[model samples]
Target chain A: DVKVTQSSRYLVKRTGEKVFLECVQDMDHENMFWYRQDPGLGLRLIYFSYDVKMKEKGDIPEGYSVSREKKERFSLILESASTNQTSMYLCASSRGTGASYTFGSGTRLTVV
Target chain B: TQLLEQSPQFLSIQEGENLTVYCNSSSVFSSLQWYRQEPGEGPVLLVTVVTGGEVKKLKRLTFQFGDARKDSSLHITAAQPGDTGLYLCAGDVTGANSKLTFGKGITLSVRP
Candidate 1:
């Protein structure tokens, strides 16, 4: 079975604070993605990495950045957290392009 | 931007009831996927339909891709309490580097 693990299951942050969400996959997948899920809005992609040191902006990448220094780890950075940024964040990994994805448990973020 | 629309955003029924969810899009896709997500967890791929007019079954769940490649459907037979969750449909466009356009999701509740 493939395992995708997120650094935090839940997080609380104050407004204007910097936040980081980490994800690691054991399957050695080549593609990793970050998405934020909100009610009525669905899952909007934040960023994705196809390979180590390679990154691409997804549909909604504003106020967020990603790091992929290694193949197994991907990190999502919130430049400055805001109340509107509170939502569930998900990380996913796939073997390669056009393949099925395996996702982490997700992190519920609360910004106050 | 590519978009997938899921119908009947929420459904509640007693155990042993059957239900069907529909996902439609204006644009054709290379492939379509269905996922089931429980609270606090990320979405899990239940099935993927690639070929047009294809039908795939997983136990009590049946998935069908439209002949036009612009729509899909998921049908659950005799839904149980354990089947309660959110159902999401995603599409992969031909030239989008395998990025998915996800629907808003359908919340299914099966009462015992």
Candidate 2:
């Protein structure tokens, strides 16, 4: 079955370290998104890409950057990880406007 | 920014009971979606409603979109242990990125 795949299920990062989280989808979708979920905050979008090499900042993109080098792969980068940045990160892909999203299993990152 | 507000942040009920959760938004959305997420997993799409005053049913679950396309509701006929999860409502604004604005979500626990 078609699915979105995240590179890691769980990650531990040190404060001030640079971190990378990868996501790939096999459905050939044109849109990819990265979101960080926290308690009482729901899912806050960090970044989203509608096409290859195209990226747009979401509501909470202060500490995060994203790359969409290919049609099926989107990557989220943390320039400098902090303790407050630790949260459940999720990746998702969709066909186009008004389309349903297929999400990866998610990565729980703990920063210390 | 568009925001979806979900009511009853937490709910606990016994099996065979019925439940209804509300999602309201002041901004009119082009489409609305409902998602369910279990522990350690990403949110999965449960249903999507695009038309105003639309109602859809999936087995024991029912979803309704408001006449103005600004709100939605989800109702379960018979809650089960397997129905326990985080329920989120998302609204898609008419834009190029098609980024979705999500609600804080409701945590439902069904006990046997």
Residue pairs that clash (backbone atoms under 3 angstroms), model 2:
none
State the lDDT of candidate 2 residue by residue for A1-112, as single tens digits: 9999999999999999999999999999999999999997789889999999999998889989999989999999999999999999999999988788899999999999
Model 1 spans > 4 angstroms off: none
**Ten contiguous residues with the weakest lDDT in model 2 chain B:** B93-102
- Indicate the residue-level lDDT of A49 in model 2: 95
lDDT by residue (tens digit), candidate 2, B30-96: 8999999998999999999999999999999999999999999999998999999999998887663
Q: Compared to the true structure, candidate 1 yields what TM-score? A: 0.96
* Error of model 1, residue A24, in angstroms: 0.5
Residues B1-78 of candidate 1: C-alpha lDDT, one tens digit per residue: 538889889999999999999999998889999999998899999999999999999999999999999999999999
lDDT agreement with native, every candidate: 0.93, 0.93
Check candidate 1 and list the clashing pairs: none
Angstrom error of the Cα, residue B69, model 2: value is: 1.3
Native contact fraction per model: 0.73, 0.80
